[model samples]
Target: MKKILTAGAFMTAFFASSAALAACETDVKKDDITAEQATELYECIKEKMREGYGSADAPFSKEYQAWKVTATAPAAPGAHGKRFLITYANETAHGEYVKFSEERADNPMPVGSILAKESFGVTKKGAVKAGPLFVMEKVAKGSADEFGNWVYSAVQPKGKVMKIKQGFCHGCHAAFEDQDALGYPVEEVRLKP
Candidate 1:
């Protein structure tokens, strides 16, 4: 029984180490990584990301992937700490959100629409780093008047609800007055309307 227990422990450690080593990593600078390469990396890490987020027991984390993907590949932009971000739009948000419209004053995102963005970063030492899952949900008119009627929240990489300051997120998003505070993905990866 002792030998069997030892073998089981060894097997568990081996698999854990294998999983750790299997993480996606690249020496190439983030800016220089091509869409194909980014997609490849995404494929390698996406499942782990989903599992991590889903561990939070949040509806969005588990359901976002079933929604429409807004970009072909993750994009690294100045926003979101320059991490690579791939966005998803729920059914309520997809039709109007996909328009990537710049006419928000008159055509705002419908109430109930939700957007989820998954992020990841690469370190200077070439290690792939998982990031939080950002979420924005549109509430009924006047519900969250201070934040353009949208609520911003996040889930940590380990599935904890991240503490988010509404004002901080809104401060930057407010710059996009024409897009209803929506910051679309960079053009290179944006899916065609």
Candidate 2:
């Protein structure tokens, strides 16, 4: 009886753990996102962005550091000719970036990929001014290049969505249709281990 009870308890615990892991929505959705998921995603990245720009109370400062800096010196809206930095959130995205030149149209960022363009300005005194944070998330499967699939949003440093538009970003990036609507020249990204 004791053996049977122990086995039953172990099985129950295993199943419960599996269910909890499955509930984690790391993979981006193919179509529209649930309000809850959108909120969570926004909040998570927003918090990270806050810390990346130096927020004392922010969590996950080290976590954001793992993100690959794919591009720097890219032109941005309000950078005032200073430059911009682009970072990818995961290995899958970085892999796509590393192979994009060779694979061309064949390779694209996976579902969970998130790209952030951290716009910053340089002062004469060599101080850095953090600008708007632009984020692009690649949704799985479908690719009409809109908010539902490839979402685009610009966020302020304090976690405000300055803008969330699809056609504006998609239309410009769509010119690079071979690279899955990506704008940055990832061929220059020095892939780190």
Candidate 3:
């Protein structure tokens, strides 16, 4: 019995370390920071975060009541995959959302608009497990190098950044220049009032 228990413990430790090392394995950008490192930075901040980027505490849960889904087909025919649900902070986005359609990609949002996007994985059982929350808030001006003035950050359910490719986010959002990088399906946006 003792021998079996010792071997089990050893196996568990080895696998845990292997997983940690593998977590940092990924392509790096010019900055030399791997997706793992960036995710680590994100997770670290999320762990201690008390508020959204430009908003008060618990913006999604407390402040925003409903989330507007922006996927081409939120109910995709798959057991597991990626999907997006979005929400806006101010009335400007809501106004645009109320009348916007996927065909109308020219709806521009004003500054000071905050968008909270919930990104999660779908289980093979069609259940929702813990996932990341992506937050983007439009600012007065963006750095010359960024996609737009909108600041982007992602946080996991436990509060950490999920690993992703460099420019993995803005690269897609860039297509919506007229909409200030809100690449969601316009027709999918919704709010109570």
Candidate 4:
């Protein structure tokens, strides 16, 4: 009886630990994110943005870093609903190159710019019920002119000037009316320092 009780206690403890760890792990490749992890990433970006701008006192500059993960819905007729994970940072911008490992030697995608792969709906909070998959790169750099303005641009490797499709942010937010319409993750917004 004593040995049996000890084994049962060990099993309970092991299961509890496993459950806790599972809750903390984020399956980004699967596009499954918990509200807690989403909130943590959101706040990190917000704080970094505030730091880069010195003060929140003027017309807000557009310098920021961000990423989004989207999962698509099933192809069946009425299916709908998707999830999105977006992370952003603000600071003095510098452009980075991007390169894909499988590309041919002649391929022109840069060497290090941050790469983003997004699916439309793998989690309950995602943006699309199911459909498009997007891959984008983000680069931050000071402006070319004398003013030395700041800029953050997301684009495809095929073309340098093509703008990213960030506009979908608004629509996704509207769906989760309780959350920020822009996928801002309100719970993570840090208080101004």
Candidate 5:
């Protein structure tokens, strides 16, 4: 009886720990989640996303974390499938991108500028799932005129390059013509220059 009871206790502990490791969930609704809660969810899953994206051997996927963050926390505005998004700008882009300007005149992202946006979704039950890493790279003028000279691509959460249609991404970006085809983060979360 003593041995049986010990075995049962071990099994109980094992299952409990496993449950804790299975998923990072929240009690709040997805839209109702606060910056603090979003941050907590980010901290819980950042490493997993990094590892998954890093496996692709892409510079943007592996090096984005070292870039300057554009927002204080992940934000949502019904874009990117309504997933929460956090953006990072590489050295070539940080100076100009940080301006967060709204006018396109005299405010184009420079060639070589690369912006990487990391995304994640919260299920109805608030179970956090890592999403893809979307990348936008600016090239020389006329290099990609139809898409504002910006090349769009993505890496799946598991490190596979996603099939991207330039027009598909540019179609939505075109709405932000005044902003040079850029979508700034929600005002409240943007880091001040």
Candidate 6:
């Protein structure tokens, strides 16, 4: 009788732990976009990039929101996958902004050369042969700077199997040092909004 009771308890515990793990693997959905709109959201980013450099007058304000896209993985081993984050400003500003970030299993900051050649298949001459898809997770809130703006945070991709990429920081800074060059300033980009 005691052996039967112990076995029952162990089974219950095992099932409970398995259930928790399964819950952690949540599937990201496409409906998270505000306005349930796509084209209008993408246009917002196009306008901001054209404006050149981020400023108070920038078309997009520092608000928290998320956009979604469909993306693909690379074929070669050790090649980091790419994704795009499309974000929008809330009440503080308007328009959309598009940014590219990546995820890898081993090296976090892979060289741009490897990224261009292996992952993107882009030639050193700056020709893009293939493009990948990505989805925005959502802007994080409660973080702010001295200006009292709502800071934004985004996940590179959406879905259950996504892993955070590494080359995002190095790649963007190297390519667009003037505009998407700088990351959110640490003093202004924390969880203390």
For model 4, the run of ten residues with the poorest summed lDDT: 92-101
lDDT of 2 by residue, 1-193 (tens): 4545588898998998666444333454312333354333333344445564544232222344568766432333322233434454556577666454634565666787776666544334433345666667777766644543577766556545565458877767677676677665434343444
Off by over 4 Å in 2: 1-65, 71-82, 123-127, 143-148, 186-189
Q: Taking the tens digit of each residue's C-alpha lDDT, what string does model 5 give over 129-189?
A: 9999999999999899899999999999999989889999999998999877999899989
- For candidate 1, give the lDDT of residue 30: 81
Query: CA shift at 107, candidate 2, in angstroms?
Result: 3.3
lDDT-superior candidate, 5 or 6:
5
Clashing residue pair totals per candidate (backbone < 3 A): 0, 0, 2, 27, 0, 8
* Model 6: residues with Cα > 4 Å off, grouped in runs: 1-5, 30-171, 175-181, 185-190
> What is the per-residue lDDT of model 1 for residues 1-193, given as tens digits with 9 covering 90 to 100?
4555588898999997776566477768888988887876787788898889989866588889789899999988879998899999999999888788898898899999999999988889877778999999999988999999999989999899988899999999999989999999998998997
Local distance difference test, per candidate? 0.88, 0.53, 0.47, 0.30, 0.88, 0.26
Model 2's lDDT to the true fold?
A: 0.53
Q: All candidates: CA RMSD in angstroms?
A: 4.3, 16.3, 12.9, 16.8, 4.6, 19.0
Where is the poorest 10-residue window by lDDT in model 5?
16-25
Candidate 1: 10-residue stretch with minimal lDDT: 18-27
Better of 4 and 6 by lDDT: 4
**Candidate 2, poorest ten consecutive residues by summed lDDT:** 72-81
TM-score of 1: 0.87
Pairs of colliding residues, candidate 1 = none
lDDT score for residue 25 of model 2: 37
Query: What lDDT does candidate 5 reach at residue 7?
Result: 83
